[model samples]
Target: MKALITGVAGFIGYHLAQRLLVEGVEVYGIDNLNDYYQVTLKKDRLAQLQDKPGFTFQFLDLCDRQGITELFQSHRFEYVVNLAAQAGVRYSIENPHAYVDSNIVGFVNLLEACRHSSIQHLVYASSSSVYGVNPKIPFAVGDNVDHPISLYAASKKANELMAYTYSHLFHLPTTGLRFFTVYGPWGRPDMAYFKFTQAIEAGTPIDVYNFGDMKRDFTYIDDIIEGIVRLLPLAPQLEDVNSLEQSTPQAPYKLYNIGNNNPVALVRFIEVIEAELGKKAQKNFLPMQPGDVPITYADVDDLMRDVGFQPTTSIEEGVARFVQWYRSYYG
Candidate 1:
């Protein structure tokens, strides 16, 4: 069994590759190694896999059409997971072009590649940000996500639509995982969890956006990986879609929400961080930023029904684990 993981150096992508390699599956990975964040951290992730068996990596970008085409043609990948994107709501407000290039155009390139190949399933990462300003609680796959306040969210929503098109037209079996707030060791530094830890340790003030009233369905990295692994071999089947049953077409496409069913308030999340660090955080309360949602709760009923699993990690445990890694890595 061979799999291809784009953004192989990313936090999620790296962890997934490690899991698959341990399963004795041949893994081919790729990443642009863009310096959107710390390139050193990305390289450290790759270093952990570079010496492992059944693993091969290439420096490639999804936006590179010819490169992706060549890669698909060269090797037969049973599964493909794309986790690369210009990831950040606030960053999108600053740099919208990056989102379009990587998330939109890059994704189209990948979809085109998968359509022409004999891939079993193409699982891509979507975001909870898609449920922009939605009044709905515990956002479900069936809920309407027609409106988006950020380019990052719109790009992810576009990915779901594009994948469905390929599944409908070309019979490309695809799955889109709408992830909630994912955090853990080796996570992105730009994330609130990581930033809060950084500032608290540095004795600086952490900005509390939305007056620290926002709630998020914080999911652990391991939990997210488990959901993906369970779904990889369980691609959507056309037969599963009855003519009068589902509202959509008879396509081999599935979408699932990978999240802890519980939503954690920002203040509570901070308390966990503070408890783990054993340090008090100086906070600066602030109003909601543009393109920011006050809450993100995921409806994981469908995910549980399909995969028999949902995220079970608590913020306390997850935060402690992250702090342990942060201390060890930084030391």
Candidate 2:
């Protein structure tokens, strides 16, 4: 079988491609390799993928409709996983168009391509940020996410709606995974965990937003990839409109919250990092920034029921693993 993975140099995408290639699947991976955080890190990821068998790397942007159309025509990929996006909540406040152009427009291009292709399944990344200040704990796949505080969250929500439309209109089979704060080895440097580790290691002060009162359903990258792997071949059949709240669209479409069902307090999360590195963080507590939410908890009951898998990695285990990789990579 063959697959096309967008943002293949990204943390989750990179791990997914590696796993599929190892399983003897031909993986065609593409990334614009934008300098969102660090181009070098993305290239480093690409370097590892390049050495693997049954893996092909391409320097392409999803916004290029001609390129994407040609790609769909040429590859005949059975599966497509779109992990590419303009990530970061705070960044979205400053640069909103990036989210619209890359996240919204680029997504439309991919969806159009999928509409025209014989694609079996298209699984794309939604986000926990879509929950957006809901007083409700344990954000579920069925919850109403109509009010998003950040453009980033809004863009992800838009993706879900657009995907539903395509699935309904064209009979396309699409799955959307609403990810929480995903972290682990080869993770994005812009993530709180990575920045916290770096600052603590450098003996500098790390900014603790909302005075460290926030909590996040921090998922390990391995766990995220495992969920996608299990859902790859299981395309949904159209269901009744009354059952829509359960994450089933009235089309060959489905959505699931693919995250750790556990939420970790930001302060406690920092403690785990400190324990791993044996260094205390000098925190500069501050008010919540714009587009910031106090907490994100995932309701993965549906995922567990359907996939028979749950994210079991503790914050302690995941942090220790990340610190080990960080020390080795930076040394």
Candidate 3:
């Protein structure tokens, strides 16, 4: 099978593409390679897959309508995974337009392309940030996400709505994965784990927002990739019953929370990091910033039922793996 993966140079995209290629799938990947983080790291990820026989790379922006439309026409991809978006909750406060342009506009472009091309399945990245300030523990897919604290979160919620529209009208099979705080080797530098590691190594003060009161379901990258792969083949199915019944549409639409389902406190996460690096961190405690949630936990019941998604890596094990990679890559 052939697949098109957007944001191929991204942390998750790189891992997902690698897995698909190993499974003998033809993978075409595109990324604008925006300077959201280190360009070198993104390039390094691409380098690893450059020699792989079934991998193809395209330097394209999702906002380019003509380019994306032409890409679908040329590639004839059976599946398309949309992962490219302007990421970062805090960054959204300073530049809301970036979120609108990439997350909303770019996503619509991809959806339109899918509708025109008759793709088999469309899976895209959503975020746990959509839960906003809700006090609800173990945020479920059925929960109301109408209140988004950040423009980034709002954009993701919009993506899901848009996907639902296409699924209902065009019968496009769409799946949205509301990923929690994904962390591991080759993770995004803007994430807390990555930033903390960098500061600890440089002997600089790490900014601990919410005064270290935040909590997150820190999921490992490998486990996330595993869940993605498992769900790829199992598209949603639709069944009608005289009485009310749960429906799984075969026309291709579903949403799942791919997470560890365990929320770890910010301070505890830092302690694990310090242990892994063998150094205490200098923290600058600060009040919670705008567009930031105090806690995020996932209810992966749908994911477990559908794809049997189970995360096995503990925080200590995951952070140690990241620290080891950080030293080897940067030192």
Residues 170-237, candidate 1: write the lDDT tens digits: 88988899999999999999999999999999999999998998999999999999999999999888
Q: Write the number of the candidate with greater lDDT, choosing between 1 and 3.
A: 1
Q: Which lDDT tens digits does candidate 2 get at residues 1-331?
A: 9999999999888999999998888999999999889899999999999998899988899999899999988889999999989999999999999899999999999999999999899999999888898888778776778899999999999999999899888888889998889999999999999999999999999999999898888999889989999999887766622226555547888889887888999999999999999999999999999999998898888888888998889999999999999999887
The Cα RMSD of model 3 versus the native structure comes to 2.5
TM-score, every prediction: 0.98, 0.97, 0.96
Highest TM-score against the true fold, candidate: 1
Every model: Cα RMSD to truth? 1.5, 1.6, 2.5
The weakest ten consecutive residues by lDDT in model 3 span 237-246
The reply for model 2, stretches above 4 Å from the true place, is 240-249
List the candidates ranked by TM-score, beginning with the highest.
1, 2, 3
Global CA lDDT computed for model 2:
0.90
* Steric clashes per prediction: 0, 0, 8
Clashing pairs in 1: none
